[model samples]
Target: VAFAGVMFHLMIGSVYAWSVFTNPIAKQNGWAESSVALAFSIAIFFLGMSAAFMGKVVEKIGPRLTGTIASFLYGTGTIMTGWAIHQNSIWLLYLSYGVIGGLGLGAGYVTPVSTIIKWFPDKRGLATGLAIMGFGFAAMLTGPVAQQLMASVGLEQTFYLLGTFYFVIMLLAAQFIVRPNLALSSITENSISQKKGTRLTRGPELTANQALKTKSFTFLWIM
Candidate 1:
């Protein structure tokens, strides 16, 4: 499940590979590089915007549903984007890749982070790094794969193929994600707490309200 989340995130990072598509898409369609760049920027804008909304949604519905929906939307958007390119409809391209696909990217981004945190309360930093590390390296893998696919299949078919691949991998990841049992969690927490002094606090703990009210928290959030 965690790895699924990682894959979802890595694919989102794969957007960095979009630049590879730019010269090809532009040469084929006669679109300006600046214009294509705008589309990419819009997609990134929506990715961040949609993530803010999806974060709460993930908490409510859980990673499985979130991952499934993200995969479907992202996959569909990629296929639609390919069709849009074939038809030379910039509006359709933006609507599919920039809006719909961006939404999926955002939802998938949060899924694994929340899940990994829940699974490894004691090693949150490690869990977070594990979940997010793929994002940093995604471009390395996706860039060449996308280039090869575009070269062999053409842009339209490449989108279709990549979309299908993302759909399968993301869906599989979501399916394997299981919520850790809270009973086991309590037992572990209790055992760890016993090892500490009379104070039962597990590391540093704070209520959400308390955290939000803190100057450092507010500063960090602002930063």
Candidate 2:
């Protein structure tokens, strides 16, 4: 599950590599750099907004279904971006890459983090760090890959190719993800406590509504 989450996150996180494509896209379509850059900003804005709501959806539906849906939207969005570029319609690009793809990014980003934390109760921090680190480091690899793809196959084709790859990979990863078993989790926790000669302590659990009522939640929301 952890490995699958990391793999899925690695692909979804390539949204950060938008800078690599911005210049190429502008040069190809004779659009202003700032205008092309707005697509990235819009995508990020929707990423945050969708994440706020998608977290609730993930809790209601399992991670597997959520991840699958995210992959579909993200993949379709990427493909639509190719069409937008081919058609030279910036508005289409915004609707495709910004709104649709961003929603997928948010859902995909949260699914793994939430599931991995449950699997690794003994190492929640490390688990989450590893998953998110994939997102953080995605640009390092994707930048070079995108550059090479643009050089070899042109920008529109690059989007098509990448969208196909993301769709297949994310679907495969989602298939392997299942909720952690409560009985198995209890056994694992017991074994870990015995091996470490200490038991882990937990804070009071809160429901979604209860969490919203907290001062920290309110402050974070405002910020």
Which prediction has the highest lDDT against the true structure? 2
| Model number with the top TM-score | 2
Q: Per-residue alpha-carbon lDDT of model 2 for 41-68, expressed as tens digits?
A: 8888888998888877888999999999
Window of ten residues with lowest summed lDDT in model 1 = 195-204
Off by over 4 Å in 1: 197-214, 221-223
**Measured by C-alpha RMSD in angstroms, how accurate is candidate 1?**
2.6
Please give, for residues 59-157, the per-residue lDDT of candidate 1 as tens digits.
788778988998898888878879888998888878888888888778777777878877776787888788788877888998899889888888999
Segments of candidate 2 deviating more than 4 angstroms: 192-201, 207-223
Clashing residue pairs in candidate 1, if any? none
How much does each candidate deviate from the true structure in C-alpha RMSD? 2.6, 2.2
RMSD of 2: 2.2
Model 1 residue 199 lDDT?
36
